[model samples]
Target: MMTPATIDPLHTPLCDLLGCEVPVLLAGMGGVARWELAAAVAEAGGYATLGMVREDPALIESEVTALRAATDRPFAVNLIPSATDPALLEAQIRCCLDLGIGAFSFFWDVMPEVIARVKQAGCLVLHQVGTRQAAAEAEQAGVDVLIVQGVEAGGHVHGREAGLDLAVGVHAVSRLPVVIAGGISTGDDLAAALRAGLDGVQCGTAFLATGESFAHDYHKTRVTAATGDDTVLTDVFVLNWPKGAAVRVIGNSVTDALDGRLFGHDPATLPRDAIAWDGDAPRLRFSTDSPLRTTTGDMEAMALFAGQGAGRINDIPPAGVRLRDMAEAARRILAQG
Candidate 1:
């Protein structure tokens, strides 16, 4: 039998990054992060991240206000340099400074100037990278933390050549604290990540089933029903946006139709055929849509975003309950070591 280790809340660097009791961060997702969800994670003794690129600066201000009102616990805001408008990013930074936001998560080749600005503003700067070189540069640039995203993640995968091995990234560099993401859906995985020398695990797919998540009922149901084979990565979704970052989404008619068409077609000329429903309906699509829809019960068309670890998730529950269980399980697993 495997031996258990003691729970050491203060031993990990992730706890220092977010000022939380533990290093379990709820990874940010555009259009899926909500104030209630973020606050619930913080309340449950885990860090929460609010996505920055999905909305305007003023909306972010409103979200910050709502989040602040809900909980005084520290939380993070994830920003993508490639996707966010420059002016809007500056404004968001200014607002975060004004509100005293605890931490900032950045990715996609951030400028040195932006890094300096955020540092000067008294916010903890966290960089997301897929390569060992990026992690070294983040350390050189003076970032406070490093989030290493793997191939099995739900959204844009970085390191196609390096693969989604968390051990590679964690052991690749010793200069900074590494936080591993992608396919982290269970306490066993979390324990393994910690043993691999990672500071913590950032999980997006695991939290989708939480009640406070902004995921639609159909989306949540699909995620609940998914297996390891349910997800696929392709550039079919965000072709309209620049770089057209590859995303892993659950298999559906939309992904099925575009199967091999992504290589040849001009993304601009692609026809929009899916009905965009906005009012009162349970299903909805944002501007950054790919026409793929997930089904729930009788519903056939709704978007379901899931990571390759979809097989690990089996049910939906409140955010607090799930997080509590994960932390307890991880603590127990660690104690066995």
Candidate 2:
């Protein structure tokens, strides 16, 4: 275990608030960040979140129960109100509250009513934003932390700015601590964010490549081999998501088929070709669903979400080891300065 003295440089108020020794946060990637990954990260002293977007209450309850069984450390449940149905979202929140989840993470849009509901239940709220305007709105909505994402982020990018630039801008205006997300995969990235006066970082692609991630092995292998250039920010994978929302995914056969026509492709006009399967359910070619561990069929045709930082990741280690190494490396970098 990393002691406070070893990771002192990387520690921030965010750590104390989130009940973690390190300031790094594992991004709650849907289908990828399950109970196993979340538990591994939390046990490693970094705050973790279970990506429970658009999931059933029973599944949420099961994952939360398993997570609590694995670690007593604090963790958060991630949900997106903009993408989920109102009734299902309400049920998800109720289930989480019943499970006594201490924190919640929301993305995409600022839903004050949802935040207020969680806050009313005495849960801490963390919101990820893409723009300064969104950050301001989230702060006003009573979010405890702001995760400023840049266009370089994988799986549904919300901002047009770069990660560091957006974080700097959001940090200037918000009284709450800010974390940068997008192209943050290495220790240097984390150290640089801290040196820039940001609170911490929220990593998705880095953790998604870890052994504990529920992402399909094919997806993990592709991410490890890909460079920043291999990623394309396109709305090509728009099915099941709000229209106009874009995602950054590694180039695959599906992306190749629509090479020049990456953007503005209407979902209604697209063919409902089933290219993969999650158990018995057929996953459409352009659906927003990424290939999970249980998925089969043409996995390459599925959305393989990865940030520009994919090039820097070369191996799939245990989630706990990966996070611990990152914190220690960041500490060394900070100490040297």
Among these predictions, the greatest lDDT belongs to 2
* Candidate 2 stretches greater than 4 Å from native: 1-7
Number of the top TM-score candidate: 2
> Candidate 1: lDDT over CA atoms?
0.72
TM-score computed on alpha carbons, candidate 2: 0.97
* Tens digit of per-residue lDDT, candidate 1, span 1-337: 5333443632486686577877788888766667878998899888889976646778788999999999999888887766777787778788878878867888767567877888887878878777777777777888887888887887666655323375355556556777888888888777778777678888888887778887676777788899868887766655435555667788777667775564343456655544454333333321244222232232343345788888988888888888888877887887766
- Please give the range of 10 consecutive residues that has the lowest summed lDDT in model 2: 3-12
TM-score of 1: 0.87
* Candidate 2 per-residue C-alpha lDDT over 115-164 given as tens digits, one digit per residue, 9 for 90 to 100: 99999999999999999999999999999999999999999899889989
RMSD of each: 4.3, 2.0
